[model samples]
Target: MGGIDREKVKGSFHRQAKTYDQYARVQKRVVANLLDQVRKEVGTPGRILDVGCGTGKLLAELHRLHPEAQLFGADLALGMCITAGAHLAAGAFVTADAESLPFIDGAFNLVTSTSTYQWLPALDHAFAEARRVLAPGGIFLFALFGERTLFELKDAHYQALKREGEVEDITHRFFPPSRVEAALAGAGFDQWRVESTLEVELHADVPALLKSLKKIGAGNASPRASAGLYGRKRMLAMMDIYQEKYGTTDGIPATYEVIYGAGRCP
Candidate 1:
């Protein structure tokens, strides 16, 4: 995509609200790991906001862990907001963007997100918003798909397009760790910690992996994708190349580079 179509992202998530958790095995793990990290490093907060809280999974888990703490969830997709509202009936839910939250300054002591920031075109504004909404000593913790995410599939796609005499690099790319750090510094976080880990999910085949992506609302929103440039002939070619290169006895590996970042507000 030239730049992510925010509306498309919202629409895709809205459509997948009900089925998201079913196909979000990797996301669940990311949330669990992020929460576990917080429990070890940040402790419990008096008030918390989970940005892009899809279906309220992370917020529900947070409620279970810290029943006394205030919980708030925000998402751009209306369907996601509705679903989250049901699960967090006693808490608060809002349809909002990460870069422009509706909450007042210092409304929360902790802000958390997982598998959400990757969809954002840039992190600086969102990080600033997070800082703007946090109290002193509050923490901004998140896990996002790093630059290396989906490398194998992107490589295969590139190869297929090259073989078909196409030159545009249509594969979407993610931000690197340096960019995240820069954003945190620009947002004037008091201090920061950032790290990365590689996680892989196995699919029976390339087609199976593509289907799983769609089911999880991770479908490509590229202009090329809309133009049907990612067409049948190229798709078959990509599948063949992916199998030959990355397929194994167990399955084809789809790798995600998860970058976890934590910043403390002044």
Candidate 2:
């Protein structure tokens, strides 16, 4: 994968800041599952920092879970940070990139992110930063989209582009679980665990899936994505390909491959 344009990523989430929660059902589920894991492994962290804390939903829940702990949130998008501030009464929200968090070393006892690492260009740098910011034995936990995510859409795009004689990449190359675990280990984390699961989400149609993705600020931010708006011909071709191959009696299926990672900075 090529380097991601940070400004474009910030812009995408900034535009969706207000409506993200409405369309982020899978994300909410991921957060709930992550919190459950946290409860099992770590009862309460003395200090917490949520990287890429979009709208601070997890932070809010963490506060309720550990009312006495200090909570903080950081995101690359300022609009998201502002929304997080409005949602949380006492926690501090900062606009910062995950790859280079602007915090002192050993500042947090727990660092977490959910459904956000896929946009990052360098997982190693992000993990290094997370490890740098965590206290000794602190937990670093996160969930990211794995390589199988959106395979339905990806296959459709591939076939559609091939038919047009354009063999170009149109999606981000999501990391596999092995790569994620290697980065965590290289970043000085110990006692690590990485798990992946494939989940299928049903959408009414191709258009509905696209709309849901846009509403949640998860539209294709890949630099390899087609340069211009997909014309009606391409759109129809992609939709037809998707429906013919992956559509079900219930609806069109969009597959989500989620990777959950947990480690302690040693």
Candidate 3:
């Protein structure tokens, strides 16, 4: 939390907002599961808050499920907020930081986030904020990428870098399920449950896969700007290394470790 630069992170998402939907297939799938779990936990919430609600895809679905309930969407990206506003059904769309929500305490009956919490610098504070904004007995449901996500690619990248006599961490940052569960508990939430799942997909090559990740702005998060680090030579090297190590009988594979969790505010 202390090391976070909120403005930089927000700007990063804003820059990629226009193309986010194109590469959000993985996110969409995870969010669908999160929604199903939320439905099971609470039949129909009277009011819902969609935190980090990227292009409002999940919000659109929620609107369909509970047409009468008040809905609100919040994200750090202004462009995403505008895009979501155009598609969502008469709901308020605000460009706001998830760590410090601009709402009164107990403002929502249910809070949901998808593929967004991993971007936060402080999961603990974010969980506290989620709990703070929810009414008593409200449900908080979210899906986030975990440490196991992109393990193959990360290992390949590291190995390649080591071969080139470079020591670099190309892995995306995310908390494990146990840490996430502890954060929720420390934030004073009750009835918490969390689980992890590995979702894998095949790609023709690393470039195709990297393009998909870039389109969603889900690339490296080292705060070291992509323009310089993601040059042609480095990219080609990464592809070659990935093919050499992880290519399967079908094609090159990518795995995403998706962590889903829900907690109730008591």
* Residues 187-208 of candidate 3: C-alpha lDDT, one tens digit per residue: 8897888899999978788878
Q: Tell me the tens digit of each residue's lDDT in model 1 across 88-198.
A: 775688899999999999999889999998888889899999999999999999999998988999999889989978878865678899998898899989999889999
lDDT of 2 at 236: 85
- Each prediction's RMSD over C-alphas, in Å, is 1.5, 1.3, 2.0
Candidate 1 residue 32 C-alpha distance from true site, Å: 0.7
Kindly give the stretch of ten consecutive residues in candidate 2 with the minimal lDDT sum.
Answer: 222-231
Give one digit per residue, the lDDT tens place, for model 2 in 1-266: 55566677799899999999998888998999989987888866999999999999999999989999999999988889999999998799999988889899999999999998988886999999999999998999899988899998989988888889998765667889999989988888878889999878899999999899888888677765554335778778999999999999999999899999998977
Q: What is the C-alpha lDDT of each candidate?
A: 0.87, 0.88, 0.83
- Which ranges of candidate 2 are over 4 A from the true structure? 227-229
TM-scores, all models, native as reference: 0.96, 0.96, 0.93
> Mind sharing the TM-score for model 2?
0.96
User: Order of candidates by TM-score, top first?
Assistant: 2, 1, 3
Q: Which model, 1 or 3, shows the larger lDDT? A: 1
Model 3 residue 219 distance off true place after TM-score fit, in angstroms: 1.9
Model 3 stretches astray by more than 4 angstroms: 1-5, 170-172, 225-231
